[model samples]
Target: MAALGMADRPITVGAVCVYHEMVSTAVEALKGSHIPVAAVSTGFPAGLSPFHLRLAEIHESVAAGASEIDIVISRRHVLTSNWQALYEEVKAFREACGDAHLKAILATGELGSATKIAKASMVAMMAGADFIKTSTGMEKINATQPTSLIMMRAIRDYYERTGYKIGYKPAGGISTAKDAVQYLVLVKEELGRDWLEPTLFRFGASRLLTDIERQLEHFVTGRYSAAHRHPMG
Candidate 1:
């Protein structure tokens, strides 16, 4: 919190993400700040919980003061080509979120193919996802360039058709300053400058921040700081 509350220029994260158990604590700690508390709901990392329980979890998280909910989509729905099921599931999750924004985690690695990833992205957006995320950061093959390209193109297609902009979040494995910059450039090239803001794009890798801070420090002082110097919350 001290790092984010820098007196010279506060560098708040996009959001403080936590499980439902810590939503209240995150909300309290970030009180008076613009950062929203995001809770990972819907069975998280793996969306295999009972259907009703998943929806109930979303409601509970929002009631706990989470302004954003990151819900994992059922990979099985995509794997089996059950687009209707995927759409309905995400739509219900969106409705459960009420006013809170919903970020749908695709778990792309488990989906098996680039085609499935793109299809899942479209269905999630169609079902009213505020953001289509790449992964839960727990998959063995989380966040790769090819998968990101597919999802970005899906977002582009959705925008061209519906004229509604949806956000994109690439989580997992993006832990370096170079990786972060590359993703930023990719977003700019694919989605244009409009998606560059925090409202439309976000990196789910917390470790990436440390590298970014180190790079900034190096640029300013011409010296590299130890990794331990930049602590993550």
Candidate 2:
């Protein structure tokens, strides 16, 4: 993903996410590169594991040297309208995160309504989530522009009330330069340019890097190239 002059230029993705076992390797691989290794934790993509086990997984991932933790929230809590449970669970994850940034994945596609998405976003942020994410990419629907709009509005409301600028990530199904630009435009028009930076905004899909490389190649050579022309770093 960094083959596109990411080491020399400021075009790198904010972080590279991987499973817990790979955290140490990714940390060492990215040492001194200023790129954080994100570990997916809390029984990611499903989050149905025992509560203590889930928290223990977070500790393990952090112990393995993950600079950021992308955790999945218990969908049952949100589905049952249990705000207090969700808040406490997310807060526990934040505490377990230690110095690592905590991103709460709402799995918005599994969520039934936009209001639920907004509320989940607020509850996660209130519990000290460093970023509120849209999905795990395992859901049937993920990272739609409409869902992103609701999440961004929630972020705006949270910032206005609490003075904390939480980040946003729309994962899944984003694979082209045009798709990325649309998201950028959405964030700019909704949350302003401040949210455009890596600190506050990130695309969670990896295929996007390949497509972006292709677009840049076309821009430079004035012609489209085959998919194999670009190799991910």
Candidate 3:
């Protein structure tokens, strides 16, 4: 893979978070690869399913060899200010994920406010989220600087207060090389380089790999490729 080949330099590819059904296949394919499997569970994107079904989705993903589980916290309940329900929902999903790392997707676009974003991040971390993710990559307006700042600040404060190093992941619509670099820069500036590693920081992107490859080619070669030119995965 081009990204894997680039690991000798400044950047490296992290885990590839996919859907529940794709976990087993991806895990087998990436067994000897550098990328880990991070599967989205708990009825991702919409997340309108019943609680039990969502929990089962998470459990199944972990059992299917996913090393990490990205579960969407109930935004409807969170927006309604049903703090207890939101807390319980995340707690339940954390239990279902077993030892698989849990990344709670706040889907920041739907939360609609920085204040709400901060509160939701706190709730997710307290509810046992290994990482508080920014978005689901389905919203037209996904990860923004304000929401990401709020979440990262919350993680820093929570670490000071509780000694837990909850991670931060900014997902959705983050498909450009410059955007990824800027996001990493923001994290380094705000949360420090201690949080710069893939464990504490991740950009949940679909087309990010291709974008990175283009940047690599532009650096190695003298020109950018045509839109149809794709690097081998």
What is candidate 3's CA lDDT for residue 86? 92
Q: Which consecutive 10 residues in model 1 have the weakest lDDT in total?
A: 1-10
Model 2 lDDT-worst window of ten: 1-10
- Comparing 2 with 3 on TM-score, the higher-scoring candidate is 2
* Pairwise TM-score winner, candidates 1 and 3: 1
> Could you give me the TM-score of model 3 versus the true structure?
0.92
Model 1, span 1-233: residue lDDT tens: 24344558766789999999999999999999989999999999798899999999999999999999999998888889999999999999999999999999999999998889989999999999999999999999889888888999999999999999999999999999999889999999999999998999989999998898888777767888998877862
Arranged by lDDT, best first: 1, 2, 3
Q: Score every model by TM-score.
A: 0.95, 0.95, 0.92
Model 2: per-residue lDDT, tens digit, 4-68?
45566665679999999899999899998999999999999899989999999999999999989
Predict model 3's lDDT versus the native: 0.86
At residue 149, candidate 2 shows an lDDT of 96
lDDT of 2 at 157: 95
215, model 2: CA deviation in Å?
0.3
